[model samples]
Target: MAEWIYEDGIGEARAALIEDGVIVAAEIEADDDGIAAGTIAEGRLVKITVPGRRGLVRLDGGEEVQIEPLPRGVTEGGRLVVEIRRAALPEPGRAKLALARQASPEAGIAQGPTLIERLHASGDAVRRLMAHEADALEAAGWSELLEEARTGEVAFPGGGLRLSLTPAMTLIDVDGWLDPAALSIAGAEAAARMIVRHGIGGSIGIDLPTAGSKAARQAAAEAVDTIVPQPFERTAVNGFGFLQIVRRRLRASLPERLQGDPLGSAARALLRRAERTPGSGMRTISSHPGVIGRIADRPDWQAELARRIGAPIALRPDARLAISGGHVDAENP
Candidate 1:
C-alpha cells in the first residue's frame, strides 16, 4: 500500500510518497533563503545583452531573471513580467535564472508546496514523519533511491538507462540488454516511471533499443505515452529508436537540485535516522566533512533537529566516514 509522509520541521519540510512502504516520489520544501521555482513576479529589464533578444531583468526584491524575446515595446529599463522556470540553484557559479513563460497583466503570482500538497490530500495514510518511519523509508530503499537520483541511473529487468540533462533536453540512453525488442518494450515503461519518479519535465529524448520494424517502434512509443500525464507529446520511435517526449515543465525538476546538493540530502537523511532512534537523549552525529559542512551552512536545520528531538545535537566531522553514511549515538551536549 502507498502512503504519504509529510514532515513539517522548523526550518525545512519534505513530502514523500511511499508505496508499499517505499518512497517513490519526494519533494523538499525550501527555507526562506532558497529561491523556489514557479515564482511569478514583475521584473524591470536591467540590461539588453542582445537587443530585442534575451536580456536580464531585475525582479521585485532585487532578484534577476533571464527574459528572452524581449516583449514588444520593452527596452532596457522597461518592465517584463515573467515566471521562474528554473530555480536559482545553490551550485557554485550557478547564478543565471531560467525563464518559463511570460505572465499576463492581470496574472497574480502563486506558489504552492511542491508535492506536499498532493500527499496531504491523498487517501493514503498521511502523517508527520517520525523516527519509526525511518525503518519504512529504509525498507523502501530511501538511501538507494537518493543515490540513484544523484547518479541519474536506473536499472530494470533486462537493461539499464542513464539520464542526461542537456541544455536542449533530457536524454535517456538505454544499454546492457540481451534482447533489443524486449529492451525497448521494458525500457519504455521503465523510463516513463523514472521520469515521474524524479519529477522530470520539459523535453525528454529516450533512445530505446533499436527494433526490427516501425510497428514495433510505434508500439513502444504508445506504451510510454499511456503512463505519462496530460499535456505531453511524443514522437514515434524513429529508425534509430529515438523517441522525443515533451512534458510541461512548471519548475526545476527535483532531481536537478538533488544531484547538485547530494551532501545536503545525506545530512537530512542522517537527521531522520537520528529522529527515529528508539531511545534518545542528546545525540552525537559524526559524519563526513562534506556532509558536516553542508549541515553547518544551515543553522536553522541544526536548531530544528534539536527542537524536534527535544535535545541538543553535537556534530563531529569525521574524515573517514563514507558518503551518505554517518554515525549517530547518544552524547552529552
Candidate 2:
C-alpha cells in the first residue's frame, strides 16, 4: 500500500508518498507560506483595479490580495469576508498576491488545513516520523528528490530532462543518446513522472525528439498519459514533437519554492540536518554566509530547533562553501 511519511521539521512540514519504497509524490509546507488557500478572513476593499470585475483587499494582517467578482453593493472601503482561492506565489523578481473571492458571512474566519491534515484527508496511511527515529525520509531519497527540484534536472534510463521555468509556462527539453523514437517515448514518461513528483501545475510545454511518423508521435503522447493521472488537458503531439499540458495551479510548485528562495530553503534544510544529528551537545551548523544570515534572521526557528534537539545550536559561516553544502557537527561534551 502507498503510504505518506510525514515529518514536522523545524521550519517546514514535509510529506512523501512512498510506494514500493520509492517516493511517488512529495510536499513541503514552510511556516511562512502566507494565507493558504481555503482560508477565510475579513478584509477591507482597498482599491478597485478592474471596476466590478476585480479589486484589491487589505486583510486584517495588512497583507493585500486580489479579489474577483466584486459584490454588487460592496464599494471601496467596505469590509467583507473573503476565501482564498490561491496562495501567494514566489517568483524571481516579484511575488504574485493571493487570489480570493467574496465569501458568505456564515463561512466564519478560519485558517486553512495544514499539510498533515490534507494528507490524512487523502485516505492513505500516514506515518508521522520523529527526529530520533531512523531516517526513513533520507532512505527514500528525499535529498535526491530535493536536488532535482532545485536544479530542474531529471535523469532516466535512456535520456534526461531539462526543465526551465518561464513566466508563461514550464518548458521541458528532452535529450539523450537513444534514437528519436525510443528517446521520445522514454522522455515523455520521465517528464510526466517529474511533474507529479514535484507538484508542478499550470501550463507545461514538453519538447520531445522530432518524430517522422504519426504513429511514433501518438506512442509518445500515450506514454505521458500512462504516467500522469488526469484532471489535466493536453494537446496532441505535433509534427515537431511538441506537446502542451494545462493543470490547475493553486500554489507554488516544489521547484518554485526551492529556486525562488534559495537561502531560506537551504537554512531550513540545514535545520533538518541539525535536528537529526546524533550525540549532540552543542550542534554547530556550517554553511554559506547567506544561509547562516537567513537562519540568524529568524531567532524563533533557532530556538525551536534547540528545543526539539534538547541542545544549543550554533551557526558557523563558511564563505567558501556552496549554498547547499552545509553540514551539521555535534560536539562531544
Write the residue-wise lDDT of candidate 1 on 1-333 in tens digits: 677667764445766678766666766665632445666777788887777677887887686767766777887888767877666543323533655346777878765345566565556677676554545556667667777777789998888989876768888888865677777878898898888777778899999978888777877888888777677888889888899989976555656656656676677778777776555677888899998887788888888878778888888999999767797888532
lDDT of 2 by residue, 38-120 (tens): 99999999999998799999999888999998877889999999999888987877778999999976798999888999999
Q: Flag regions of model 2 displaced more than 4 Å.
A: 69-71, 104-106
Predicted structure with the largest lDDT when compared to the true one: 2
RMSD of 2: 1.6
TM per prediction = 0.86, 0.95
> Residue 264, candidate 2: how far off, in angstroms?
0.4
- The total of clashing pairs for model 2 equals 0
Q: On a 0 to 1 TM-score scale, where does candidate 2 land against the true structure? A: 0.95
Clashing pairs in 1: 131-276
| Model 1 CA deviation exceeding 4 Å by range | 1-3, 9-11, 19-24, 89-101, 109-115, 118-127, 131-136
Local distance difference test scores for all models: 0.73, 0.92
Clash count (model 1, backbone only): 1
- Model 2 local distance difference test score: 0.92
